[model samples]
Target: MDQRQDILAQWAADQIEQLYQHSIPAQMVTVSGDASFRRYFRIIYSENGVHKHWIAVDAPPEHENSRQFVDIANVWSNAGVKVPSVLAFDEAQGFMLLEDFGDVLLHPELTADAADGLYKSSIDSLIELQQIARTDNIPAYDRKLLDCEMALFSDWLCEKHLGLMLSCDEKLMLNQVFETLANSALAQPQVMVHRDYHSRNLMVCKANPPLHDKDFIGIIDFQDAVYGPLTYDLVSLLKDCYIQWPREQVLAWLAYFKAKSAQITDINEDQLVRDFDLMGMQRHLKAAGIFARLSIRDGKHGYLNDVPRTCEYIMQTARIYPEFAAFTEWLESVFLPALNKEKMA
Candidate 1:
């Protein structure tokens, strides 16, 4: 084990001892990690003759904000959302002891037959999350952030990863498209947005007949929650980067989300569709760029496999809006062919 993992393991043991009066923990086993710098592990030990399991987090103080994660978990948990409870944490060392939600992520369980039920539960959880009153800690998904995130596409995916230098005209057109997307986001009603509210971050507990069970949700990787456009999370769920759903099915779910979120956000289907479309464009660009950054800068190349799917979302949305016509033409005629060549070579 590395020095940091050893430190985290010792820290977790001491914390467990304090929590249950000398309850020693077993060796921590590595759990799956995400695109970020954080690592997770599962620890099991006996307490009062019953086995107890907890997930230990190594967030690395320089790379992650453990304090914000604990704070948001508390905030959302109190709001009746089912988040992994933060049992304890050390902000300085960036270590945390979290409730174990087992190994069931919502992604693999999302079958064609079970999609509707599982999504219904997830959508309910999302609406409840959005209803949480904004706190000072919650950041606004503002114009600056929106534009900065979208620029990742041109900067990381296009220039850094794809080696595509944009012409002056191409650069200007991309900027305009970015501005249009950001404005569309800013125009929508702001709500509590779990920035990465896709299937992978969600855990499926007791996935059975009771789809509406509030306790069935096991939400993780929610440290980046923001006050943003209502449609952002919805689009992330339906047009997931790692998975694809039929357009007709996606629209159907969008309608359900619109109906479910009506009390919190008021908008007609046409406007919601437009906002959802444009908001998706913004997110997919950000996601594609993030995936590229993950591959090139972070040495995590598996995420590159998902870039095409993310770009497909962008291409599909670009086709829907006339304002994105130039962007669409550029993508079809220039960007996609470059991506295909990059992959082939």
Candidate 2:
């Protein structure tokens, strides 16, 4: 077992003993994922003639954000989103005992046949998330936060990963693009945006059936929820980093989401399309930069393979906007070719 597995095993044992206060037989099984800072384990315990199992998330206070996870999980759960129920949490140790939602992620369900239905349902869940995000009670997804994330693209990916220094004009263009994207995003009606609403973060519960009031979509890794643009979560789902859907399917889902939004929020369809595309571009760029940084700085090379697709998303989106004509030209002539060469070599 690795260090993470060992820690999780110990945490599970401790939690069963300390928190549950049951001197019952307990077994711990580590779950699989590419998690960096946190570890997850399923704990099975038998007590008082009943058998129960729970997922124990061991975040190791120094390495992860357990508090945010607890807070945001509560918020989403209260909003009728299907997330794991929190059974118990220890903030100091960053250990959370949560309801086990089973381990079937949406990634394996993305075949050509099931793609349409899965995406349609996924969009419905996303719309529900947007409706909840629009509430003023949630925290703001302000300009500073958006700009800070955008800056990571410049500082880490452009300068550090690609070793390209932005000229004055290039910097101005970058700023203008991000400003337009951010303003458009911020101006949109706010909602509870799951900053990382992707396939991996979603779980399909087979063991425990969903409640009537709750959604079938079991959301996880949503600690970074923000109140921002309605299109942000939509883009995250449609332009997913792990799995790629065909353009036609992506458009169909987009149209479905637009109609849903119009019905709920009375937003214009064309503007929603523009916002989705622009937000996708911004997100793709950030994802590419983060992927590169993860490889170079964090010593995680698995993400490097996904950089090309992320860059492709940026290139594809840039082609649709006339305002980005110059940037698009530069991307095609300079960035795309260079990235391709790097990939091939």
Candidate 3:
């Protein structure tokens, strides 16, 4: 191992021994993560001639909340969601050893012809999560969280990162759009939402159940899950950041989810459409602001490439509604051209 990998391995071995009181040689394999404060390593060990692998999550205490990770994992596991099993944890050290669900992300699978089956399964998993959120134990998804997320577009993307300010009429139209969207969202049936539900966070585990463990869908990066609109996670999966599907395919999946959801809970077709669109708007805007912030604050310039597509999603959705005309025009005039220039450069 190189110096950095060696240091991480040593640290993980020490932490694992202290937490589990089991002495086993640990080899750390680096794992990929999205734009988050946390990182992961796969730790392999042998004990009594039996080999096993565990996922070690290294969330530097200063940057991430390990306690929240443990709590959310427990909640999802207990609710029948396919989250990694937490074997051991050290809140003080911000280290957690969990069941390794393998490294294959769902992105590539969604692009292949097999996507039809995978998407259907993914939708089923989403429905299961929503059911978990509907339980009374989870807190209600309140208004403050919704408004704060929407404001990120104005604060980060429009002003701080893009270096452009919204005019009086423009700002008013923006708020009007959010108000309409948020009101529609608030009216929906609240459920447990994996805020970042998408292809990247889901793993196809054929070793477990639905067929092979491959049939089992492993959920990861769910520390931000909360009670929210039923359509929030759905939109996240359908309108994924890493991949895009045809409109007909997206609509078919929406219809499939609508039919499946109705069997278990109450949801009208018109209401589902409104919630899906509004939630898509919210998520797309947040993604744009986040990509911009990632470029500016985190200095991860690669994310800047995704700004155009995300902005396009926002413009496409915004134009469909008359109330957001000004915001749509502003995005077309200001954000799209600027982002396109940056992409070309």
Candidate 4:
């Protein structure tokens, strides 16, 4: 192991000893990490003849906020959304011991036959999370953050990834499109948004008939939750970048979520859908840029594979609106060809 891993393992050993009254086993396996800098380790040990497991987190305080993660876990738990319980933590050292949710990611297990019900359970959990009512204390997804996220498209995806130097006209058009998307997002009702509420961050607890009996899916990677557009999390769930659903099915789930959200909040279901569509465009653009940044900046090239699908989401939305016509054409006639050439070369 490297120096950093050694230090983390030592900290994990100490925490495990305090929690279990024994040192951890010599074998600790690394869990697959995400776009973020955090690392997770799975520890399995026999406790009184029963094999038990726990997750140890190395968040590296300089990069991630472990305190916010723990606080959000408590908030989500209180809000009735199932999240990994924080077993132990050392904020200064950026280490945490958490309850293990096993390895059943919602992404790999979801099939057409089972998607309807699983999605329903996830929607219910999302609604529960949104209805927390008093979220004024959480950071707002304000205009500054929204615009900065959209700028990543030009900064990372276009310049850094594609190595494109846009003409002044092209730059102006992109800026206008970004502004339109930002305004549309700002128009929506704000709620608790789990920033990365996609399938990959969800854990399927039971794959049976009684799926909704308890928390159907365990929520994770929610340290970046914000008070943002009501439809943000819904779009994240229904219009997932990693997985594609038919437009009909997408609308069906959108309608279902709209109906559920209406009961709790004062929302016009019809207008809510327009917001959903626009919000999706904003998210897709941001996601594509993030994936590009992950590849170019972080040296995690696997995420580059998801960029095309994310771009398709942007194009799909852009084509429907006259205002986005110029930007849409640029993406199609200019950006996509460049992206394809890079992939082929």
Question: In model 3, what is the error at residue 87, expressed in angstroms?
Answer: 0.4
- Model 4, 221-301: lDDT tens digits are 999989888888988998999999988899898878877775435666667777888899889888989999998888999
Off by over 4 Å in 2: 1-11, 17-27, 33-36, 45-52, 133-138, 207-215, 262-265
| Cα TM-score of candidate 4 | 0.93
Task: Show where candidate 4 strays beyond 4 Å.
Answer: 134-137, 207-215, 263-266
Judged by lDDT against the true structure, how good is candidate 1? Answer: 0.89
Per-residue lDDT for 276-328 in model 3, tens only? Answer: 87789988888888888898899887876776677667777788778777778
Better of 2 and 4 by TM-score: 4
Clashing residue pairs in all predictions, respectively, total 0, 4, 10, 0
Residue pairs that clash (backbone atoms under 3 angstroms), model 3: 133-192, 205-213, 205-214, 206-212, 206-213, 206-214, 206-215, 207-213, 207-214, 208-213
Per-residue lDDT over 1-345 for candidate 1, one digit per residue giving the tens place of the 0 to 100 score? 799999999999899888966667447999977788899999988656876678999999999988999999998888888888898899999999998888999999999899999988889888898889999999999999999999999999999999999999999999999898898899888889999989999899753323235348778999998999988999888889989999989999888887877544557789988988899999999999999999999999999999999999999988988888899899999999999999998
lDDT scores of the candidates, listed in order: 0.89, 0.77, 0.78, 0.85
| Model 2 agreement with the true structure over 61-91: per-residue lDDT tens digits | 8878788788777777798777888877878
Per-residue lDDT value at 27 in model 1: 71
Question: In lDDT terms, how accurate is model 4?
Answer: 0.85
Worst 10 residues of 1 by lDDT: 206-215
Q: What C-alpha lDDT, on a 0 to 100 scale, does residue 272 get in candidate 1?
A: 86
Judge candidate 2 against the unseen true structure and give its global Cα lDDT, from 0 to 1. 0.77
Number of the predicted model whose TM-score against the real structure is largest: 1
**Comparing 1 and 3 on lDDT, the stronger one:** 1
